[model samples]
Target chain A: MEITPTRVNFEFNPHVPIIMDSGIFKAIKSGGSSREQAIKSMYEDNKFRTQLSKYIAQNQGNEEDTKDIFQEALIILDKNLRNGKVDEDQNINAYLFKTCKLLWLNSLRKNNKIQLIDFEENPEELVTNEDLETFREEGKYKSLQKALTKLNDRCREILVLWSQSYSMKEIMKKLDLKSEAMARKSKHQCLLKLMQIIKSDPNGWED
Target chain B: MNESFYTELLEIKAQGKLNPEQEALLTSLIPQGSDLSSELKAYHLAKQAIEIDISNELKFKFNEWDQKKKSRLFRVDFKTISIAASLFLFLSVCSILWHSNQHFSNRRIVNDHLHKFNTEIRGVNSGPETLSDRIGKLRDGLEQNPTLVIQETQALLKLSVTGVQKDAIEWTLALAYLENNQNEKALTLLKSINANPDHSYQKHSKAVLDKLNSNWRVFLF
Candidate 1:
């Protein structure tokens, strides 16, 4: 006797758990085109900029200062997101405002216009100390990127690809190398060269 | 393991592509006290740092937007500056007009005091050769022939006369000096008359002195 197979239909439920990769955190994790879209959307959104500008203006800052602080805050935010220092559910606007406020305060401190202890009191509970540490790490990354530019095109290409997590086999095929060993050796030599360059200019990595 | 072998393992480990056996092998090869651990850490940091890519296109977009905002602000600043300049000019013009009117009014008061003195001289009538007649002659020639009035007033003052006649002769001499452009002599005579409390021309002299002293422009016109 032949048996007929029954069709099992599953209805969509609103309460069911769905993984949505729509937020800035997920976009940054995805990198490439998605990361660009996320950054563009965040930049074009006037709410964050307006709030940040208002905060900076109230704290002895001008329009130009606001622009600088906002741009820097956006870059730091992007870096922190990419580094997994920011939580997925964190409010991007609030995070940006706090970052801008801290950056401006830091600038004021650097200029001797404010005491460090004065702005440190009652720090926002939303931005943890770890998040602030990421800002400093972001500076180091900037210096590293600057050092990366001094290398030859071939070295930069290999190092960039390696840094992007391309396997040895993939890197060798992409760069038309003879073998994985050659790719590894080239990557190691390029890194060593990069380190040498960084060592030559000790002050370059101080940031 | 050799340097290249360990570096390959470390790179794989950084990429999170190492299997359990490879991870164990890397851990066993590079002990915690080994210098390769620091190398691995540095390699990881460099990888993470270089992965942060901020596109130049985004930076260019932001700079373009900033330039547009700055140009807008500059346009607003120029308009504000123009309005402020216009206001400053208007206030300056008004101030000048007000000062000119004040100077003109002061000059008119001085002229009125001189006219009152002339009218008083004309009102007084004694017969010919009297102090009143001599003062009348001085007043008549005060405008055109002040030199003759000065000479005659000096002659009249040398004679002993009544208090009223003395006051009239001194007043006429002062006016003659003023008409002859001898303002120092005129001011001296007027100050003397103003210092005398019982003199009949004391109040008129004080008024003319006040007007003359109020503004130097009064003397120019």
Candidate 2:
């Protein structure tokens, strides 16, 4: 059976378990191999793919655009989950769809390519306060990426792992640290250096 | 709250392992409306942006798409092809050879200027260690490594030196740059020398510029 966007049934297939109902969020929060596995499953899921394709088709978007928006939405969702911003009662699939749709609309409005009818039929302003928040988030993400390039390769790697919520034991093993303490110290130092660099740059945190 | 407290709170928040009591304490200490809370959220977002890796499936798909695009762009049907492409390719090769010959012929004039500068006139040695010795070394170095001579001459120009000494170094550097196939840099230095009325090498620079401006073989044959 071809999976439709609204088809919530995943119990028939014992091979690929469903990532609905906060399961994927919990996997991502757990970090390490679990997060990687969760992301891979999401990407390869037929239902998820169909949902993305359906959403993109409605908005005059292509496969490439759909893939990019889906990936970005996942990252934002994961960030929100980690920051305790996501409501516990929210449905993951619906949340992902809505966020991805808004992101695409924001992108269209940003490039001024949205047709007059598209805007008129919607009636509400496309450039809402939420779009402004997304814009600010994207801007900060860009600045953070730029600042990351300024760091040493080793420091950057350590911080990346640390940011993903890797345990000190895992970090020690990965980086060949002498002990968990060494990993902790290195992570702290690298994180501090990154924060200092970002804070010093006015663009990273605008007044 | 202090910056350190906020930093630690952000680190803990990013880890997503805060217990209920710890979470309650954090919420009580730093309210949702506080800038510190906003900063923490921003840090978490930045961390997420950095840590998240794209899936291998996406990467493989991108590679597949790229290869398909490249093949589509370069695909040609031999039976239905025109001879214009072959003719264009042949003409392009001939044009490139002609341009390379023109470049080499122009380089010969610069070589001649170096030969004349080394043999006919002597560099002023009024400064520290005799300018003639340095020029001789640079000339010999040029024979082996023109790029090295260019760098050495540029360094010498940075030194605090007299009028005659500076002009001598600048002129040599211009020649070195020309020999290095950097015609624009050579033209710039030569123009500066020619523009300076007090420069001892003004006449020689103007003469070189005139020849360079005229034709590739103006000074030769």
Tell me each candidate's RMSD, in Å, in order: 17.3, 26.0
lDDT digits (tens) for residues B1-221 of candidate 2? 24334446666765777777766666665534555556575565456335432222235544565576557656644423546678788899889767646654546656767776766445345344566679768876775677999989888877866666677788788888877878899889999999999987788788878777865444332
Any runs in candidate 2 off by more than 4 Å, and if so which?
A: A1-21, A87-89, A115-143, A202-206, B1-6, B10-221
Model 1 chain B: ten consecutive residues of lowest lDDT: B48-57
Off by over 4 Å in 1: A1-22, A116-124, A128-150, A157-207, B1-23, B27-34, B44-61, B64-221
The interface root-mean-square deviations, each candidate in sequence, come to 4.6, 4.8
Enumerate the chain B TM-scores of all models.
Answer: 0.48, 0.47
**Winner by lDDT:** 1
In candidate 2, the residue pairs with backbone N, CA or C atoms under 3 Å apart (3 or more residues apart, or in different chains) clash, namely: none
lDDT of 2 by residue, A77-180 (tens): 66566545666566677666656766776676666655333232244422233432433466766776777777788888787676666788999999999998
Q: Candidate 2 vs. truth: CA RMSD?
A: 26.0
lDDT of each: 0.66, 0.65
Q: Candidate 1 overall Cα lDDT vs. reference?
A: 0.66
